[model samples]
Target chain A: MCRPLCWTYASGVLAVLAARTDDTNPLSGLVVADRPEPDVPEGWRLVRVKAAALNHHDLWSLRGVGLRSDELPRILGMDAAGVDEDGNPVVVHAVIADPDAGRGDEVNDPRRSLLSERYDGTFAEHLVVPARNLLPKPDALDDVEAACLPTAWLTAYRMLLRSGARPGDTILVQGAGGGVSTAAIVLAGAMGFRVWVATRDAERGRRAANLGADAVFDRGERLPERVDAVLDSVGAATWGHSLRAVRPGGTVVVCGATSGDPSPVELNRIFYQQIRIVGVTMGSRDELAGLLAFCAARNIRPVIDRVLPLHQAIEGFAALEAGDVFGKIVFTIP
Target chain B: MCRPLCWTYASGVLAVLAARTDDTNPLSGLVVADRPEPDVPEGWRLVRVKAAALNHHDLWSLRGVGLRSDELPRILGMDAAGVDEDGNPVVVHAVIADPDAGRGDEVNDPRRSLLSERYDGTFAEHLVVPARNLLPKPDALDDVEAACLPTAWLTAYRMLLRSGARPGDTILVQGAGGGVSTAAIVLAGAMGFRVWVATRDAERGRRAANLGADAVFDRGERLPERVDAVLDSVGAATWGHSLRAVRPGGTVVVCGATSGDPSPVELNRIFYQQIRIVGVTMGSRDELAGLLAFCAARNIRPVIDRVLPLHQAIEGFAALEAGDVFGKIVFTIP
Candidate 1:
């Protein structure tokens, strides 16, 4: 049992903890606390966190979706860019699974869990993770940019890079301004894919175009032509468009359906045209390494919406919950 | 114009033609008639009919769904096995497209059409097809068995084989009685996959088990454990079970939604667990050739529900339309 580890900083650590879980108002449980540092577990290393990105996942945890109240009074950040005790700057791969049991793919392991789900995550001044989860941070990206790569960026990597898309193929990214959508836009462009974006917000569409999108469309606008693939994160709102925009034998890769699942499954259209709908989550450590190398090689930097002091993480969560931010909201652990 | 090419026996040809199209009463248009024999076009050869399989496509043609009234009175068989001009047994490939135009996949060719779409189809006395579309029928399968391979069998092949299933992977086929479902049961067993079937009809379930299904369940019955992949064709009725039956990272492969598309696309479960929904159409000629070779080598034969004489073609179609047949229905031409 978690015995009120807050306000009694035995080993001197400050963290953004979930004091309680409130599904109706997720942020109601937000608390900044001073807690004892986590002991380095077997085969794990303690990392001094430099930056941690705030994802919708943090809010979900606060809402007790993946995090339980018994596990509450727990820390809440999943993506972190930090320096290990060895003083090497690194990015953390959040998935924790035994590689040998999963044929070298931790994502396929059924019992796998991510940080902030079953353990105290990286919101603290120092956090512990399996040593294998650490990858050298690219020099081209700072700590906050590297912080965004683990969850949202890696998910987009697995969805786009592994969707069997070649360099010259055209892919459509549905929903602009969201972390995964914008990340896909940048990654697709850098990887030589012809990228397009759709959004209700014209300002976000213009920003996506400036990020190298070939074209931008109003939400539900007609595509110039059918594309080879579509990346959808906005669920009910854009799912129909994602299904309709791909060419015959093309694919629709999904990571999150944030808007919620839409009605009328569109089975006839899927079968008649021969489309593929692939679901992706956070990628493997090997993939994360590749993403780092690719970012370093291509000089790609993740887009950051805003960064706030660790003690002021509530402002970050409030911005994310309000849905006013364009990209990732990172917390600087001070 | 079709010009009512019906009974008069003017040119000594026997065929099942769509005399008219009626949405409410499709069978009224289905007519077994005597018409002018097919003339061999350039680069095409006359294949003296031996056996032709009855499929839902013919019923659809009669219902004005792909075949229009202007295209009515057109002969309507899609899968045929017969002797070519050289007097060698051959199975006709129904799809017609330039492989070079679609990266060696005609299914990707935007304007590609299947037999009975733009040209006269296989249900006729000495139907003619492009020489390239003919693959020598295997010695192992008789005319009736070979006739079932092109449409139902080939579509099942594409769905299961291309669904990325490895030998010994557990896959659940949702329906039990349809041509594709039975074909999947046999093919998956032959390929070393652990196959299961779910059927509402107890007799069909017993038949499916006899065809080598590892296990059988009542329609929508709870599975013992989630499987690696699910094959769905009974759309609205089984779509929910399909989504629920697959493990995280498992796939839901579909070829046809015979039951109509269902509502509430289940976006939450899909994104949360990372499931794949793949849509498959008919197989390619190369894939068909491989299937034929596999069947011949494996000593596998298509299961026939019944075989009727060419003049009694209506009985075969009626059985198919009524959904009373558990396997393929073939019509033999004397």
Candidate 2:
């Protein structure tokens, strides 16, 4: 899956840029440009990009959160798989945190930042990352599939494994068709959880069944039985239903709030029912490794909505921004 | 602590009753009465309650939330230390659940209810509870302190232990002077957590320091450092502060919503900083047993603000209603 770095970057390097922010028109800031190669910091390795996946985080960055106009001309992609300088096939761990600070889990570090937040991201032909962030890419998953795992899949993985969920329990994934929701459906099903999904779109709810969800409900549709946990990423749009879906003493795990803040924290319901609300980030390297093994063992392939050549990546971003993409959109560098 | 069952209820049992519900004036519902003794049902034991403690739950019952006009004349205390029919000193675990349903944890049982919710409670000369609800009281804590444990102190205990708080962590107890807050300060300190407190009253802040809080801050005052967890019972008044006080990956353990529900669940902070909000109700029988042993072993007696005779319980309830009481208020039966 390794692509020659210099072929695409004839003069310098080709990268997708969120050059500035316009909250009303986030895509207006995006620029495809040829730029100087990023200087590798000490203890960091330069990887020749093979493939990368898009995330809603990129959209958030373009909206001036996590990425700012001051940090202009920033490349935007957190999940990537490529060949390191040493020629080892590897996946880049996007989070930059002192491992010691997080007690061996980088995601828990207070000062943690993801790729493109403070550093150049994987949209380029070559990218620099902490050497320690490299994980041996599994043989089972191709570069594009491996690229999708670091951000969305890893987040969903943590929501299941680290969010205190046990096997043989039913879990409600808040959205039916987003990257994390689709990943969670497959991962949770493979891991023996009875997966249920909620969606406002009837079509998406039906499509969710093909992704291995045991049951699908219309958004806010009351269920006959309470679930043991809920994996929520679609914030304000689904928080109340997420809280209501779980059983007494069950957990509601949150990784993202795409729809913004929810109304009424529902303190009364929380304490009365003894619900546990856990906030999850991307994941730990150890968990990423476990996810890799888990996926390989179960033959769990992440759902890919579409694939595009790196030069056509802007279309992928536009499709994602329009919410037209169901699963992940991966860009393969020529 | 072994009181004779027939002594107090010689004719009819003396009890405090929520005779009716008045939202505007909650205390108007409370009445001193000589009511018929509750017959011990199958798998239940009759207890001659030697000491009973008050909680805001009693106030809520009178406010027509937990109790209704149909369940009028219901005894209202959830905490009691008494002598069972076998004459063994015991404390009542107020939660009523079918042990089989919760997988050995009664608090997790969906059908679980507190004593006063659907049955006669411990504010009487005699009360009946399931046999499993009795835990032999340790001699170290007398009837008054032991009675305080099953509801407030055990709630604090569970909030600390079951809420994912670790030892050697700093826990901020919101509100310096409530029964649960004071209990949290004492228990968290004895359990090796650095205890911080937030309160508006200067006198209560000083009093909290005396209760083993390592530091005290005015309510909503910005702290120099984030805490590992926050014990929140103050609800809306301190919800934002509690969310702000905990570090990323830290917890806000909620057991009550006295002030009201927090508006706009801070979903951005919850997901962005990865904050956990764990809800804790009164603990399980096993946890109550551990709390009993822990308090006895540590010589940690609950702070009682005042003790009133059963006949003068109205005055005690008034002090609680006014929020003038700093610690637990217990009623001793003659």
Give the top-scoring candidate (TM-score): 2
lDDT of each: 0.86, 0.88
What are the per-residue Cα lDDT tens digits for candidate 2 across B72-144? Answer: 7688999999999989999999999877777566788999999999998889889999999999999999999
Given candidate 2, what's the lDDT at residue B312? Answer: 76
DockQ of each two-chain model: 0.70, 0.72
- What candidate 2 gets wrong by more than 4 Å, as runs, is A1-10, B1-10
* Candidate number of the best DockQ: 2
- Give me the TM-scores for chain A across all models, comma-separated: 0.96, 0.95
Please list, in the order the candidates appear, how each scores on TM-score for chain B only: 0.96, 0.95
Q: For candidate 1, lDDT tens digit of each residue in A157-193?
A: 9999767778999999998898899899999999889
Worst 10 residues of 1 chain B by lDDT: B1-10
Per-model root-mean-square deviation over C-alphas? 3.4, 4.2
Q: What's model 2's TM-score? A: 0.95
